[model samples]
Target chain A: MHIDTGSWHRYMALPAFLLFSLFFLFPLMQGAVLSFTDWDGFSTPSFIGFQNFVDFLHDARALQDVRTTVLFALGSAPLLNLCGLALALLLNKKFRGKQVVRALLYLPAVISPMIMGSIWYLLLQPKRGLFALLLQRVGVSGQGNWMLSSNLALVIIVLVNVWQYAGMTMVIYLAGLQAIPLEHYEAADIEGASSSQTFRHIVFPQLIPSLKINIITNIIGSLSVFEAILALTDGGPGYDTESLSIYILRMCYGNKTGYSTAVALMLFLIILIPVFISLRFFNKVEER
Target chain B: MKPNTTIVADARKTRLSPRNRLDWYLLAIVVLISCVAIIPFYLLVLLALKSPIGGLAAIRLMPDFHFVNFITAWQRSALGKAMFNSLVMTAGGVGLLVFLSSMAGYTIARFPGKLNRTIFTILLLCMMIPGIINTVPLYTLLIRLKGINTYWAMICVMAVNAMPFAIFLYSSFIRAMPVSLEESAIIDGCSWFEAFWRITFPLIGPVTSSVVILQGLGMWNNYAQAVFFLQDKAHRNIPLSISLFFQQYGADWPLMAAAAFLGLLPAVAAFLVFQRYFVEGITAGALKG
Candidate 1:
């Protein structure tokens, strides 16, 4: 049952190299090149240099999209990770109806964001939705036209993202929680540590790995958030919920390709920062 | 650890007591959150039964159970073609993804050296590059390739986006697998490729199934890619068709809900069946960090 690793590596490496070059490297390099140019689909790029980048900074709507994207990333990332961590902590203990509760909690994660957006669009319609109807019953008029406003729509979109993604974050946290040796908890219990103290001492330290991943993913996803917003408002009500992706779609397909690529470049830079931060942070924390 | 007498006594008291006010408070909070997650689908069904105009006038708490709305949406929306397109595209994408990723994962895992690490890191970088960031160039490429109207283009894009995570999962799973099995196969005169196909692939089934389930859900539920790539009405997939249904029947809440229900059925079914493994697959990808 003996074999050589050398021949096997030689046999497998070539195809893997080919696949990576074609699928990963080629498109990525081309994207970087395109970001700098004003290439329309038909003609060769005129090599406009840094003009696209300059215009991206000055464009008011593009800037607002950046602002809204940051707002969403900042708002949703912590909330989703924290909420998921809390849920995982609660469900980790012995309980009744725990599986059913966990299933119900995780159900929203499986539903498509676009479908959820449609449902919310109907349910949150002004003056006629369930929320408004209930508000009317309670003597508040106009409780439902929330998405019609720009900031409020952004808030709601963030909330929806939280609801959808928290299930995933929770599952990852649960795995991290389970992997924490019981001896640590027993030691804490033996020391007569308060629940809060034990959480800060043991659970918080152990959850760093999962938290790093969840925060980075949530930030990146919220920055590029599109399908739900598109299905919900089409970035309407004066482009309130328009994210970088929606802006890019408008540019590429909406006869604003030049402008959209500018937006895309900004998105690339924005996501790149968080990714680098996450990598550095995770490495440092893990080292300790 | 320093033992605190008073804290120990309080902990014992809390442990001895079966139920507490705090536990009740926690239970109530959990139930409330669960209800928040559950109520939307119920309301969607409720809204679908009543007249769209009536529903627009005032929200009804109870569903009218108008199943006919689904039929109406199906007939008017060209949902049949959309479903067909989605099934074919997802199947094709999963097939290609499983093929390419397994080969790459096999190479990376078996090699376990500098080149492998480089390739794996590049794949991770691929994962971080949000799909939208490349839309301009990708769209241009599709247009130039004249693949805008074809399912093959959509399938290729999906497979590429899917490859990195797939390779990651497969590599991790394969690395954990004992090398002796492949060694034995090779000793029996199996070539390296044959050893992978005969010995390695079977052992990787659990992870592969999980990948298939996850990617299948993603490809099935996708909307933006289909919208960007498929211009012809006849070429549109289910998600795009659902969006189209909304456009065509903006006033018909019942019909739109029906269309959504149809659009979501496959994914929801897969979710229910493979929920456990799907969770495992996700944790594997994220926890490696």
Candidate 2:
């Protein structure tokens, strides 16, 4: 098994490597080059290095999108981890109908973002939507146009994102929770450690790795928000819910492919900064 | 809950243990959170079955006995054919991914070399390229290859885009496995490829299933790239079709609700049927990350 011919070795890795280079790497390089040029779809792209990015920087809507993207990522990721941790703690214990509850929580995630957003679009449609109708059933006015309001739109988008994804973090934390050694808790108990003391001393530190994983992923996913926001608000009520991805899509439709690519590169860089920092910081903690 | 087998029972044995309690408070919290999570899905089905009088004016918990909305969505959206396209795309894409990456992963794990290591690292880095960034370039590449609007184009891209994580999972699982099984097979006059096919491949069942569910669900729910590549209405996937349906029926809330449910049906059904694999796969992927 150890003595493999050079031909077979190449054979084993050829398909994946070929596919990756052609589909993933080549396109990325193309995007990189495209970012520096001016092309409006049909016309030939002319070299305009740094100009597209310069324009993007000067663009107020693009800047607002960056702000919105950052806010969404910041608001959603932390709350996702917190709610997930709480749910994980709650579900970690043996309980009746545990699987049913877990499946229910995860159901939202399985639904496509477009569908989820559309459902919420109906539910939050101010006057005669599900929420309003339900509220009216209880004799409370659901009169406010939820998605039409700029301030509430971004908040709703972020909340809907958090709602869909918290279950994933919960499942992660549950896995981390179960892997905790039973003897550690027994030892803490024998030492007469109180409930909060047991959790603080024995559980919290151990779940840090899980928390780190959830945070990084939630950050990446939320920052890439597009379909849901598109379906829900279409960045409407005036750019309040316009994320970077949605901004890029809208630009592409406006025949500003080069600029959109430049914007995408910026968004990509913005997403990476925190992910790398969190990963490095957490790896250090894990080592300790 | 178990008579003598659970941590709960053990906790109950400790007189002053906080875990000794029935944890009703925790259960209530879990139930409430689950309700919040599930209400949209619940309402999706409920409203789909019932007719709306005036742009979603009616709201009821009980599902009406009618599925006229379903028929309307299906016919108006041409969803049946579109769903077929999506199913084919997912199967072909995920199948290609699992097969190719598993072989590559096994090779990488079994054979230790600088080339393989560099390749794996490079593959991991490829994912950092935000997906939207690749849209235009990939489209250009597809056009150059005369691959635009073809099923294979989408399938290949899906397989390749998702290959990094599939390789990650496969290689990780393969690394954790003992080499003795493959070694014995090779010693019995089986070729290395034959040994992998017969032995090594069979042993990596959990990770393989994980790859299937993760990538399968991903492709099923994928909409953005499909919108970019599959421009023809004849070739649109389920998510795209549903989105199109909603746009056409912008004011028809009940029909839109039905379309959304129909689009979500495949993924939701997959999750329910393979709930165990989905949970295990997600948990394992998270931990590995």
Candidate 3:
């Protein structure tokens, strides 16, 4: 194997660049071009000249979907972060069975959200579901299927998502917590600082960086939630739980490809705006 | 101390005492929360074992004591076939992802040239782009390319999705490694590719394992992409099989539960077998960088 460094570098980079081009870049460019036209996906796309964008702008239903998507993201992201932080705090203390608890909590994060949705669907079924039956046994009668009602459907979806994803956030936070010097906490205690005072001054101050990445990533991910929403609600009960991803999916796959492309582009911008802001925010924090 | 200040200090000390009854109360509350988390999973296991027809009628806080449902679900759903398909796809996808990602990573880390940095930045930016934006176009493109109802379509998508993260991890790990190893190998007349294979690759065993396990579990349990791509029932993967199991046996809670449990096997097994790597893989970039 008479090998040279320079030429080998070229060979190494070649396959990866080609792969990315074929699989990633080309389709993205094609998607951008197609977004401008009316294509049913099967037929040749006719030039529509911003008609899709105009149609998307006027679509009240799409606007509502945007609201619902934001609601889901806002509600779930904070709750997940809090739950993760709380768990990390508790688990950071020396305890028996800590490893087992960590493993169990992280289990749901590894499973696909689609599978989790399916499992929860069966478990949360109103009439014959386990929760329903259990509620009956407890003498607390409930009226409607949780998944059927618009308000409850949104809440349940967010709660299930939090449960599934909180573990990963917890792991990240725990790592952050570990990075904090133990001596800092000790010094705070020596200064007669109360637990809450120590948390505010020492723990929370140090958590800013983790919060920056965790909150931004989780919110971006929360807005783009599609698999679980599709499997569980299918944006049903009249588009109550219809996220932008689901909205775009219905447009792209179900009925209107052109209109959906516009909506998808909007969803991209919505995701991008917050992410850009968050990145800037994080940079500012780092610089400080 | 003065009488008034002494009274206030005594009250504060009582409140702040670590061994107070309030501490026990808080512990109880936390234990209660943990129980709530555990009980549902316990019930799921019990539900999976009960007889379908007898299960709902016999629903209780505890197991109904029927284990045959597992056998029936396994027999009826062709779970074995689905598992085989999932394993094949995961193995193929992770295998290619590791090799390709590490090569690019090594070049970027070692060379650090303008082109490499620009490409790396592009990748890092692409990492933030939502996968949904790519889906509609990717699906249509696949259909046009006649890749529907095929594993290749699913494999390609999963591999590409895993690429950015894999490269990110590999780049960080390679950069952490001393360049002295590569330089030494170069002096021994080994080429860059050969040096990477013999030296750099060996050193990255832990990270490589992490990538394999993390991506492997993800691909194993992946259903959304598979559902869209694999139109045939016989060709559907594990998660889809579990989903179809629900649709078919909606009333049969035991069978559906059993099938879901079976569907969780590979993911559970992967997590257990490579638990350390899984944790490292997840917490690496977020925590360290």
Q: What are the lDDT figures for the candidates, one per model?
A: 0.77, 0.82, 0.78
TM-score of each: 0.91, 0.94, 0.91
lDDT of 2 by residue, B1-289 (tens): 3665777667657644456355667767767887787777777787788765533554557777468989988889898999899989999999999889999998888776887888888977765555776777677678889887789999998998789888988888889999888778767867778888899899888888888887788888888889888989878998888888878888877788888888888888888998998999887776765
Q: Name every residue pair that clashes in candidate 2.
A: none
lDDT of each residue in A1-288, candidate 1, tens digit only: 345545655445456456556544665578666667776656666777788888887888888888888898898889998899988987786668877777777877776778777877777767667666767888988654676788888888888778877887898898899888877877787788887898899989998888887878787787788887887778878977788788888777565565566667678889989889888988898899
Q: Which is superior by DockQ, 1 or 2?
A: 2
The lDDT ranking, best first, is 2, 3, 1
Interface RMSD of each: 3.0, 2.1, 3.6
- Answer with 1 or 2, whichever has the higher lDDT: 2
Model 3 misplaced regions, further than 4 Å: A1-4, B1-23, B52-57
Q: How do the candidates score on chain B by TM-score?
A: 0.86, 0.90, 0.85
Docking class of 1: acceptable
Residue A117 of model 2: what lDDT? 82
Name model 2 segments beyond 4 Å from true: A1-7, B1-12, B15-17, B52-58
DockQ of each: 0.49, 0.62, 0.41
Q: Is candidate 1 or candidate 3 better by DockQ?
A: 1
